[model samples]
Target: MSLFEGLSAFPITPADPSGRVDTVALARVLNRLADARVDSIGLLGSTGAYAFLTREERRRAVEAAMATVGGRIPVIVGVGALRTDDAQALARDARAAGANGLLLAPVSYTPLRDEEVYAHFAAVAESGELPLAIYNNPGTTRFTFSRELIGRLSEVANIAAVKMPLPADGDFAGELDAIRSVTSPSFRIGYSGDWDCAASLLAGGDAWYSVAAGLLPVETLALARAAQSGDVAQTQRLNAAFEPLWSLFREFGSFRVVYVIAELLGLCKVEPLRPVLPLPDTARDRVAAALIVLRKHFA
Candidate 1:
């Protein structure tokens, strides 16, 4: 089966009130998701506050997750860094630590041209034995890989899949169709930043990498299954129910609110990392209200 075939929960790295990674709390979150039957777990991705973590912290977080998951399901570690060598090294470390695959988010600095990005992936592929998935989140990287670039990278021996963050606006349907048409037939496309879960599936995403699913796995899995089964009504019902929580991302800039709400929901205990400040009192109140509404539907 393809690595991207089913629901994968992107668990936020739980941190203590002082902002140190709370390994015990993180293990609990992973155990709960495993119990919910999520197909896989992705560690240290954007939802996990990867950018804020020191290299050692990232390694420790993966170790904690692996201990909890313990071969029950595959783990895909996000390997993104300012330097190509660092990214490759992280990929190797993740593989050595028992990760089944690596998710490479494009390097942010220097804003590489398409060919350069491909070369970077090529280098990482050559360095690691594990399969690799390209994580394309233009909003974060400021450099979105073109379909042509993805097509080229898909040809790389170890490049297994592409994770495209569905654009918040513009012609997403057209964008998806364009991507589907251009990418290699073997390349799986998993939606990353999208929250319109049902609509994204209807539009033909093979799978979803969701932070919300970490908190409400059963509901998220049900929504994905319903959509996949072609039950439009049930899918819409679930999607509509999630609209309030989804709006949190729209109104407030970052996904920090969702992370905080996850904590409020008892899914994870991670606090927001540096520079990505905690939600303001007003935003916290808003998130609290949204969580109340979300629990009514998802719970």
Candidate 2:
């Protein structure tokens, strides 16, 4: 199976306001996912606030992840930057730090053409010397990838998988078929939106690049396994337990809500980086209530 297969838990890079990473707190969070035995750990992902951290801080985050859970689980570090050279450098840094795989997003201040994006990925894949997943995050990057572009990138050496956004038409099967027809069969396809990933799995998607799994790996893994097994009823039940949290994620963004989740669960106490404010008191109350629902179901 591809290293990207199954539930890849994405954890926050617990850092203080100065953007300095707290390796101890980070290791504690990673230990939870490692102990839960999640399929992989996606460090420095969007949920990890990769875009907000400098390359130095990003390298520190990857080093901490590998030290904590590197041998226990595959670690896919995000190496996205506004410039291709910078992304390539980040990829190299991740490889040197012992990351097992790489995730790259086309983060451009100006809009990037498809060819530019493809070349950027090719350069990183060549330099990184590790399996890389295309981070197809149009929501943040503002660049939607055409199916043809994905097809071309799949053939690139070391570009092994693609972390897709939820299909807008809500047709996982149709979307999967469209992308698969163009790409090689071994090129893994995965989805990121936490609420819709079970359906994506049930529809034969290769993986779930999950945010919630970062903190709730045990519960999230149960849901992913149920969907992978084609147990529709059990999948629905497990997903229901996460519905409240999903709603909160959609409302406040998982990036913001997860910091609160870590604190609420007593894993860590931290805030989102500046320009991305912490959730309000009312929203924190909602997040707490959402956790209650999940606890009741999983307990």
Candidate 3:
């Protein structure tokens, strides 16, 4: 499989409230995903709290993940920064730490023009010198990539894939077709929204860049497999099992919910970085209830 294809589990970078990465806990999380045989590990992605972490800490997380995964699975480190140069430095750090690939989001303090975003991506891709997936997560980055820009970036060296949000119009096939029409045959396209990812896979998406898979790899992989095989009935059944969790993910955001999951699973005991509060008691109770529903199917 391509580095970007299949189920790419994006795990939380377990850390203390002060933002110091707990390499041991982080490795435990990666080991769980690796044991589940997720196709790839998306280290330092949004769920990993890459933005809140310092560059040194991000490097530590990548080194820890690469060590734990240890060539068994591809590790794609997220290298996003407000400044292009900082992002390039991060890409180089990831390469030095033996990351198999890179994921870059167009993060900015000021809104960026298309040309500027292109330049930022090109510079980071060149610096990383590894397969790079464009993270088109406008919800967090607040910058969307137009189809024309995606086509243009597909031509950039090392820019081999993209991680897109769920299409707004709910037409995964049409959106996939439109993007495939613009990019080369080898340039892969994937989606990150957990709720509708099975449909994306059924509609021919190359990957599921999944936050849910980070914590529920076994269950998520089953759904991915069902969808990828065009087993509509099976996919719907599995997706239904995940409905409660997906509802929690949408309500509280996967970033917060996954931390709660890690604690519930005994994988780690930590909170998200400050300013991103842990789910309040009421929402956390909902997450617990959601997990109970999932366990009925996967346990």
Off by over 4 Å in 1: 16-19, 167-177, 267-270
Q: Give each model's clash number.
A: 1, 0, 0
Judge candidate 2 against the unseen true structure and give its global Cα lDDT, from 0 to 1: 0.94
Worst 10 residues of 3 by lDDT: 62-71
lDDT per residue for candidate 3 within 17-131, as digits (tens), equals 8889999998888888989999999999999899999998998898888888978989999999999999999999999999999999999989999999999999999999999
Tens digit of per-residue lDDT, candidate 1, span 1-299: 67776677887887765456888888888888889988888888888877777777888888888888968978899988888898888888887788888888886777778878888999898777788888998888998888888888888888988887776584557877777787777778878654665667766777788877776788788888887787889888888877777787777743687667766777665657666778878888888887777678865
Error of 3 at 233 (Å): 0.1
lDDT, candidates in the order shown: 0.79, 0.94, 0.93
The C-alpha RMSD of each candidate to the native structure, in angstroms, is: 2.1, 0.7, 0.7
Residue 291 in candidate 2, Cα distance off native in Å: 0.5
TM-score of candidate 3 on Cα atoms, chains taken together: 0.99
lDDT of model 1, residue 32? 80
TM-score of 2: 0.99
Off by over 4 Å in 3: none
Better of 1 and 3 by lDDT: 3
With a 3 Å backbone cut-off (N, CA, C), the pairs that clash in candidate 2 are: none
